[model samples]
Structures are given as structure tokens and as C-alpha cells.
Target: MIILAATPIGNLGDASRRLVEALETARVVAAEDTRVAQRLMQALGVENRPRLIALHDHNEREKSADLVELAREDDLLVLSDAGMPTVSDPGFHLVSAAIEAGVTVTAIPGPSAVLTALAVSGLPTDRFTFEGFLPRKAGERASALGSLADERRTMVFFESPNRLADSLRAMGHAFGGSRLVVVCRELTKLHEEVRRGTPEALAAWADDGVRGEIVVVVAGAVPRTVDLDTAVQEVLLLTATESLKDASASVAAATGLSRRTLYEAALRARTR
Candidate 1:
């Protein structure tokens, strides 16, 4: 059996009783950071220390097969430095291997910075997407942001403290300066802070520098209505140069309008 356990993002007190039990009872424990796991066990006053092995990003692939084999005979506990395993963590590979091998998999749910940040972001949480981290290079980051410029669901991203300013600047350029965003820093820790403002304002503030773990939530693009007559004329123009299907897709992508609506408009334009 493979048990994917949740570790505290910051506060050790957030560790659940089930998580503590799993940590103490597991025959084998795979952790992102063995040292951190040791410290956590010691703090929790756990007596029996399971055989611990490092299972970070670099070693996950090489070690997953061995771990899954071990899980076949005994309970294996998988944990990350923080939050749930397999979520922006190195546990996905191991989980996949275990499932393919028909091993029983379970989880000990606990605190998560992603949920914590989203709940307090003051942004619409009815629908959202978690973008784990952005590309480090400036050009790659901007290109990534450009693709999401019209995303209507709130977007979440995890970022390193050193790159927060650069990421915010890129967001401002892609999503517009007036777009709303919230930066949650050192979440669930002693110095937890939430800064909310336009991307431009946040970028300016971050220029002075910030620190600690960061989670950013940005508002999605607001949908705008285009004139029906204008949309029909545009679709007609596009169809002259492309197929009806291609024309409708192009119009929808360009105007942020529904593909169905654009196709209907195109049909009406063709008839007229």
C-alpha cells in the first residue's frame, strides 16, 4: 500500500493526527527532504523512525520503481517538504508507478498553501486554475502569460521570492496594469501577509523586494459583448479567406466570443 501524506506548509501544529499516525507506523517513508522529515518527527515526539529515503525531483524517477516494489509488501509513506504530495511536488511519478503496479493508494489530507491563498485572495474562487510555477526566462514567461490573457477563471501561481517582481511585471504586460491580483506571502507562517492591488501597483511594491514562500492569484479576463452585426460581418470577411469552421474558430479566438455564437452569426451572414 502507498500512503500519500500531507505535510504542514509552515505551522507544525497543522499536522493532523492521522498524518502523525501514518508517519509513525509506516514501514518505509519517502520524503522530499529527509532532514526536514526528521525534524518534524522529532518535534512531534514520534519514537519509531521509519527507514527514510530522499525522493525529490531529481531522484523521483530513479527511485519510484523500487518504492512501488516495497509498497507491494509493506505500507510506504510519501511526503513532500510541504502540502500534499503529487501537487507541484515530486510524488506524481511514484503515485503513477504505484497505481500501475496495482498497489493500494491512500492519502492523509492536511493543510495546503494553495487553498489558503485562494480563500483569502478576495478573487472569485467559483472557478480557478492552479498554474504551479511560471517559466524563469523573461520571454518564456511573457509568452505563457499571453496565452492566458483571456482566461476567465481565476488563476493561481506559485513563485520564488527572488522572481516575484519579474513575474508580476510580465503579468502586468500581458494582463494589463489594471488587472486585479493578490500576493500571499509566507502563508500560514508567523509573518503571513496578503497584498492586493492592480498588477502595476503590486509590481511597483515588489521592486523594493519581498521574501518567503509566495502564492499569487489573479482575476480572469472580464468577458465583453461584441455587436452582433459587427461579429457577423467579421465572420464573413474571415470565411472569404478560410473555411466556415476555420473562420468561426478564428473569430472566437480574436474576439473572446463563443464559437457557437460566431458560427450562427456566420451562417446568418452567408444567408444574407
Candidate 2:
């Protein structure tokens, strides 16, 4: 059996009773970081001496099979440095391997920085998408934010403190300066803060440079300042670089326009 456990993101007191019992009795555990696991065990006052193995992004693929074999004989516990494993953390490969081997896969749900930040974001929560982490490069990050300019569902993202300000400015460029945003810093921790403002305001805040784990929650998109003609022009602009079909689909997505209509318009523009 493979048990995916959720460790405390902050406030060790949030550790569940089941989590403690499981850690107390488990003979073997795979952790994102062996040292962090030991520290956690010490903090939780668990006396069990479980064999700890490293299972991070670097070795997850090569080590997943061996871990699965161990789970076949004994209950193998999987955990990350924080939150649930595989939510922008390591665990998917192991879970997939366990499933393929007919090993029972279960989870002990607990503290999640994403959900925690979203709940306090003061934004719509009924529909939201968790975009784990954005690309680091300026061009790529800008392109990523540009693609979401029309995302109507509330969007959540994990970002490092260093990149927070630049990301906010890039988001402002893509989604407009006045778009609503919430930056949750050191969530559930002593320095916990939830700053609410426009992307421009937050970008200015980031300019000051801050430290802590960060989660960004942005309000859902509003209607675009586009009409049928404007949407067709956007399709045409993209078609200069992207295939006509691809351009039509992209523009339609961004403008909530009809793909077929955009395609036909682009086709007619070519003839004229």
C-alpha cells in the first residue's frame, strides 16, 4: 500500500492525529528531503526509526520502481517537505507506479497552501485553476501570463519571493494594471500576510523585496475590450506567425469569439 501524507505547511500543531500515528508506526518512508523528514519526526515527537530515502525531482523516476517494490511488502509512506505530495511537489511517478502494480493508493489530506491562500484571497472560489509555478525567464513568463489574459476562472499560482514583483508587473502588462490580485505571504506562519490590491500596486510592493513562501491569487477575467472586427484583426495578427487554424483558435479563446467566424473572416481577408 502507498500512503500519501500531508505534512504541515506551517504551524506544526496542524499535524493530524492519523498523520502522527502513521509516522509513529511506519517502518519506511520516502521523503522529498530526508533531513526535513527527520526534523519533522523530531518535532512531532515520533520515536519510530523509519528508514528514510530521498525522492525528489532529480531521482524520482529511477527510484520509483524500487519504492513500489517495497510498498508491495510493507506499507510505504510518501511525504514532501510541505503540503500534499505532487501538488507542485514530487510524488506522481511513485503514485503511478503503485497504481500500475495494483498497490492501494490513499492520501491523508491536511494543510494545503493553495487552498488556504485561495480561501482568503477574497476572490471567486467556485471555479479556479492552480498553475503550480510559472517559467523563470522574462520572455517565457510574459508569454505564460499573456496566454491567461482571458482566463475567466480565478487563478492561483506559487511563486518565489524574488520573482514576485516582476511577475506582478508582467501580469499587469498582460491582464491590465487595474486587475485585482492578492499576494499571500508566509501563509499559516507567524509572518502570515495577505496583501490585496491591483497588479500595479502589488508590483510596487514587490519592488521593496520581501521574503517568504508566496501564493498569488488573481481575480477571474472580465470581458475583453474586443468586438468581432477587433477579434478578427487579432486572428490575422497571430496568423502572421501561427497557422490560420491555430490563430483562429487562439483568438477565439482570448476574445470569446467564434472560431469558425474568425477563420472565415481571416479567409475572406486573404482573398480581398
Using lDDT, give the best candidate's number: 2
Shift of residue 203 alpha carbon in model 2, Å: 1.8
Model 2, 1-272: lDDT tens per residue? 99999999999999999999999999999999999999999999999999999999999999999999999999999999999998999999999988998999999999999999999998999999999899999999999988888888899999999999999998899899889999999988999999999998998989999898999999878856688887888888887799999999877766777889999998898789
Writing each residue's lDDT as its tens digit, candidate 1 over 161-223 gives 899989998999999888999999998899999999988788889989899999999998876
Off by over 4 Å in 1: 229-258, 267-272
Q: Over all chains combined, what TM-score does candidate 1 have?
A: 0.90
Number of clashes found in candidate 2: 0
For candidate 1, the per-residue lDDT at 207 reads 89
Error of 2 at 252 (Å): 5.4
Q: How good is model 2 by TM-score? A: 0.87
True-vs-predicted CA distance for residue 112, candidate 2, Å? 0.5
- Whose TM-score is greatest here? 1
- Model 2 Cα shift for residue 223 (angstroms): 1.8
